[model samples]
Target: MSEAAYQEKVLEVEPYGIEPIPREERHGRARQMFTIWFAINLNVVTWFTGFLGIEFGLSLKHAILAIIIGNLLGAAFLGLTSAVGPIAGQPLIPASKRAFGKIGVFGLSFLNLVNNIGWLAVNLVLAAMALQKILPLGYHSALLILTIATLLIAVYGYNFIHTFAHWMSIIIGILFIIMTVISVQNLPALLSQSAASNGEFNLGMFILAVAIAFSYQISYCPIGSDYSRYLPENTSGKKVWLASYLGALTVCIWLEILGTLTATLGMHAGPMDFFAKLMGVFTIPALITVILSIFPVNAMAIYSGGLAALAMGIPLKRWTSAIVCGGIGALLVSFGGGQLADTYKNFLLLLSYWIAPWLGVVLSDFFYYRSGLAQNSTTNGWAGITAFVIGVIVSVPFMSSVLYVGPLAEKYLGHADISYFLSLVVSALVYRVLLKFRSAAVPVKPLQFEE
Candidate 1:
């Protein structure tokens, strides 16, 4: 397609790069966030996250409470960051440049790029495994099919992703509801039976469960604004925040609760197996829903990964970036296979370790320092970078992962990983103190872009 024609078909065809979106091109409903986030959270990976809570030794009651607390906390950050979209009129990375400065934002962009690609590969592998269970195809074949499908959607970019997610929310939402109804028939017996937790309350395990759930949502902060950047500038921030928050929170809570119930009942099989057991003869539809849901979720990952790469000074077009990112992810999945499974827990913990500190700095800069202005400034990026590094360093002694346990974590904390929480608090507090002493090195300037 010619450039002009492609621009006509899709809104914001330029892809904006680090530029703020022009007012004339901004168009979309704030409430669409409901469908976008709702659909995004409906997937096998999310269900697996809930399953991990049980594996970490939480009883059904504690698991549900932890999931609720984690989602609520994470959703608050997610919603606030997303609300910056229409106001800043840029993707998450560029908008973040306002706080981190041009150089410092690159640090976040690089980490975000890695996280996005890692998430895409993880999603594809899990989705492909579920597909293999339903069809006779091998894992490689299913992975290939899913990769191509997701790439096609992502190459079309933002408008298409929004439209796709809107319709998907309805379809997947109804299907999962039906699946839940079928599964609930056995809930009475499941609730009456004792969880295999040895009847002891473990605070350390409970905190770990909350961290897992919180990390899942916070992982999206780097890309939270990507979908909402096209909304009209005058769109109510409150509406955007509420819509996204409620949408993600509701679905996350429901699915995790269902997952907890299933695990508690000893039907601790993977998502497809549990669905097949409950749905019986209607298992085909359930399987189809699970497979169909992968596209929108993975497409978001591919799309946002490309945007982060672009922000880091990669000159590729958005579509080209999508293709490149998806190709790399596919290659990783093909070679890594089962080895990736072993790293999944550590991968998630590693994500929290970096992202929580990053969030602390970004949120503190925007709310406390910038007075909520979305304008970029010329400052020594070193201060924020120093604060972030210090946060990570301090968190080391508190981290507990299979890869390595910190001395403080193992000796005193009973193996609970509160490193993420510690990093968050430390980074924000340090950034605030540093900002008071440091002044901008150059005048603030608005970003410039070509028409």
Candidate 2:
């Protein structure tokens, strides 16, 4: 069947995978990017990310500054990369093939698949935790229910996901606004409250906070274009970029600040518990909102993970992939008995360990290296892969994790984890310089696909 005909018939199923989305299948406004990102970022996991800095002993004022700076930087990358989707008409993995070779991108795709599944598990666990608190279901049952709910939405594919995000953005946005207002009523007093002794100003903690916040956004880099590829090719790149940036930034800052305020007020419970404490009799509503908000976020993760698996040459339909990925995440949540706070922190840091370098290579290749090369030529896969390895190696000594703090991390910068920064800078510079020495081979024939 013609790709367009297939797309039309399966309106609920995303027909195009690694192939460029046919122009006839592309029809959506740039503004939808805003709502999609906005809805996804409204997740409670984002709030928990903000609260990490407070746990690190940074004062509220400094932590907020780090959050702002980190989100701004991270959002820039997310926005720029998302703009590539419409022009390339492909998801992150396929788009990456332009810079990283067909073979090179597979390794990244495999890693991306793992990362997406990790994120899916984390989000499901958090939502399930909230639901368990609000309802009588056991934690395992709540995990199962949340995973199945998110999987169903993701299995319906792109159009349904977009539609779901649009409506959820409106609903959750209003509910959160109400929660924000209630929380803000006590903000003045919270602001005046002295920082916890652990919250004493510390440079190490400040940097760690920024890294965590930055990781939160950049972790989405692999999937940034997944949502935008369905938009028309003529869509204004600038508009798409701005809409995405504004949407994610607006929600992230608001929720992070709200999270910081909650932490400041001595709310040590999980995200929903924090909300329940603030809303009093409205706790049930607040709890429900928190639970429902995870749908778009986790759905995105599962959807993207499935796409990444396909990019890595896995043979499965998108819906089948979603089921497989969702099942894996549910299994982890059921058996992984670690405390939520510790698990979240470790996951965020681990996320940065890989993503920081990957972004560096991707941005450098796309903006600097590949832009100057011919459109259809074969890329020097080794250059990017080698550069990525070098970046990881350089990052190890600067990493700070519960697993192991690097020697350099403890010796310099007051034990702050600067691995993300170091890795990004090193990888970009290496890739850019390497590109000058390499030459693209002859134009390769395009893959034969119905699209």
Tens digit per residue, CA lDDT, model 2, 258-349: 88877777777756667778888778778778888889988998889888888888898878887888887677667754255357546645
Q: Which residue pairs overlap in candidate 2's backbone? A: none
Clashes of each: 0, 0
Which whole-number lDDT from 0 to 100 does residue 449 have in model 2?
14
Q: Compared with the true structure, what per-residue lDDT tens digits does model 1 show for residues 1-451? A: 1122222245444455555666766788889898899899997667667876677777789889999988998888888778878776787666666457778788788878778788788778777876887789977888899999999889888888888898999888898888788878888777776444446778888887887788778878878888888787778888898899988889888888888777776675655677778678778887887887777889998989888888888989888888888987777778756357447536755665788887888777766532333554566566678788888999999887667678988888877778878998999899878876776622333222111
What ranges in model 2 sit over 4 Å off?
A: 1-3, 6-11, 195-200, 270-272, 336-348, 369-374, 441-451
TM-score of each: 0.90, 0.90
Model 2: ten consecutive residues of lowest lDDT = 442-451
lDDT score at residue 161, model 1, on the 0-100 scale: 85
Worst 10 residues of 1 by lDDT: 442-451
Scored against the true structure, residue 252 in model 1 reaches a CA lDDT of 87
